[model samples]
Target: MKKTLFDKVWDAHVVNSIENGPQILYIDKHLIHEVTSPQAFQELEERNIPVLRPNQIIATADHNTPTQDQHLPVKDLLSRNQLQKLSENCEKNGITLYELGHKYNGIVHVIAPELGFTQPGITIVCGDSHTSTHGAFGSIAFGIGTSQVAQVFASQCLLLTKPKSLRVTVNGTLKKGVLPKDVILYIISKIGTNAGTGYFCEYAGTVFENMSMEGRMTVCNMSIEMGARGGMIAPDETTFEYIKGKEFAPKGTEFDKKVAYWKTLPSDEDATFDKEYFFDADQIEPMITYGTNPGMGIKISETIPTLDDASFEKSLNYMGFKAGESLLAKPINYVFIGSCTNSRIEDFRIAADFIKGKQKAENVTAWLVPGSKQVEAQIVDEGLQTIFEAAGFELRQPGCSACLAMNDDKIPQNEYCVSTSNRNFEGRQGQGARTILASPLIAAATAIEGKIPDITKYYLN
Candidate 1:
């Protein structure tokens, strides 16, 4: 049959069809975090149910852990309690936990790939929207609610209505300064955030095929924001090579067989999609979110949108940005480049290269946080940490950190921050703090200039 990658994976996972509605799909992996697992564990206790597959379930503390000091107790009482509850729950359930300060501890999405826990041709679920990041390896992964999390734990399966397939192709070579982040943002702006509703998008194009694994993950991570059920890229040599020596990846002959299977996971040449879209990589520029929503973005060289041309005035007013005002020269109080979206080693390497021999702007508060302890180790071994430290950037522990305000790292009220985090919806970083999301390269340039600049000048060089 002419089927897309989503169709093939969905068909393989479905145990049975439930009348004309959702089907029962087997889950191969379940990842839990501090914020969402506590409620699910409580539900299990109330119902007197034991986790069906504790070995397959992995837990981590990221959302509420302090980034500055991993050894000390968390100061925020509520945050501390949340972490405690999760630890107690995991202990009682006998689930494997990678607590703060552990080598494996990191953002759930980040640790999964680094450890090779995320593999191709399997169904993976997490209580995080960014679980879509796993799809970069050609797997079917998605986020579930608390109740659904409980359901997966009980049965290792989920009831889901299979999403239709959509193919989005970017055919040209990307221009200098145009990163995978910019490419996805440009697609969202062109297609509207809701355009991919009820579909699983397959990003298949020359640009995507040539992109590094980290870049592929960045685009897939934001698939949910575009209203897609999820997004996936075919597992290729690059994907396999990245997972080869990781702790959880198949070893020896097992790996060769796994690769053989992964190779066939790509859609056949005659495969069909429910919908299709195309993009020109060369047309994309360095992107930044100006308004409240992620889709409310523009090129770094562009001016802030006016109310007449803007989609939402209330959001712009709340963000303290005026129409027709240029965002390039605006002053910034903080610059951050650590998040599941952009905290990978490649991201830090790019940022380090830009600021290796220079100093950060005196007025800017710059932070460089790796996505995982493994990445932190890589940076130290590669001497990237020395480069960043010499430039006056503070290196912090791996966790969700300031990506969400649950952690201690936060932007003060009314301050503007150039962050590499996913969400820019007002106050995502902290209460009443304004956020502008950009790539790590653009973030480095902004830190050097103390405001958004034409990053192409530095990035291209």
Candidate 2:
């Protein structure tokens, strides 16, 4: 019987299986951040249970962290206390921590893969949903709740029923200006949010094969948006190359041995999936969300669809949009180009390349945020910071800025923001804030245009 990438990795980590019941799955990495971890730590402390695998746990402070003023004291008392508790918990548990202002500090999803903590054929878990981002390396990664966090802390294992396999294949050359973000938005728009429910999705075909590591990460990061348990891409040369020479990656012969194992982790040629879908890449375009959920997206050149449903009307009403109305030239006030989904160095490079000689519109307040401190350093090292500053884009420090309204950076009520983050749920960016999810290129273009433009001319060639 042929096996899939998910099956291979998941089977390897199974510690015990009950007859027709949940299996005990070993977790290779447990990532934690300030907000969700404090409760889990407190639960363990109250019960006098020690963290079983401190070595496997990595802690960071990101959610609710202020994007400005790294040196000064944190202003939000709650945020400051959470950060302090995270530090104390990690120290008590003997787990390694990358605190705020630390070089390795960043969004939990961002720092893991960049620092070589994420690798192929491993099971990773975090309290945050975007933890699925690590599945770009062919891992069985997903999010867990606070109780599940305590379970992992107690045993470094989870009792879970296996998810069915689903594969999405897209072949053919991607059109110009259609990015990885666009490809995912296009998929969600076609399949809707519930298509991947009760499934672990595997991305396949030449389109994913040809993507760089950064692009693959971007694609996998949004897997949760479609309601998939997680998402995966088979590890290949690109995956190995990205993991090599990182801070925590094995060196020399050790790395070669690891690669030898990784090469065998891809799905077998004759493997069968529970469900499969194929798409033509040429049909995809630079996409943007028009409604509350990610599935309500359209090509930049298209108008809103007329759907008859109370929920549909509710979404349109929240967005202040009408059926059959084109978003072209619709004025926008805020634009954000950062998140775990698209805040990699390549994303900034794309935005910098586009905005190099151009100035942002006077009416738009554009914020450019890196995903991690390392990415922040790369921005300065490569002089992308100068280009962004000269183009009138504010280059904010790294955090989950404007992606969610947990921190100071927010989109005002009823104002429109063209964002590169994953979700566009109503008020996701702030109270009553309307979000239009797009690729970094679209976000940058929106900042320059001060509105949603029919960027067909720029997108076509």
- For each candidate in turn, the TM-score is 0.97, 0.99
Per-residue alpha-carbon lDDT of model 2 for 189-288, expressed as tens digits?
Answer: 9998999999999999999999999999998998898899999999999999999999889999999999999999999999999988899999998999
Worst 10 residues of 1 by lDDT: 304-313
Q: Which parts of model 2 have CA positions greater than 4 angstroms off?
A: none
Candidate 1, residue 297: the lDDT equals 85
**Candidate 2 has what TM-score?**
0.99
Total colliding residue pairs, candidate 2: 0
Per-residue lDDT tens digits for candidate 1, residues 180-231, read 8888887887787888899999999999999999999999998887888789
Score candidate 1 by lDDT. Answer: 0.88
Each candidate's lDDT (Cα)? 0.88, 0.94
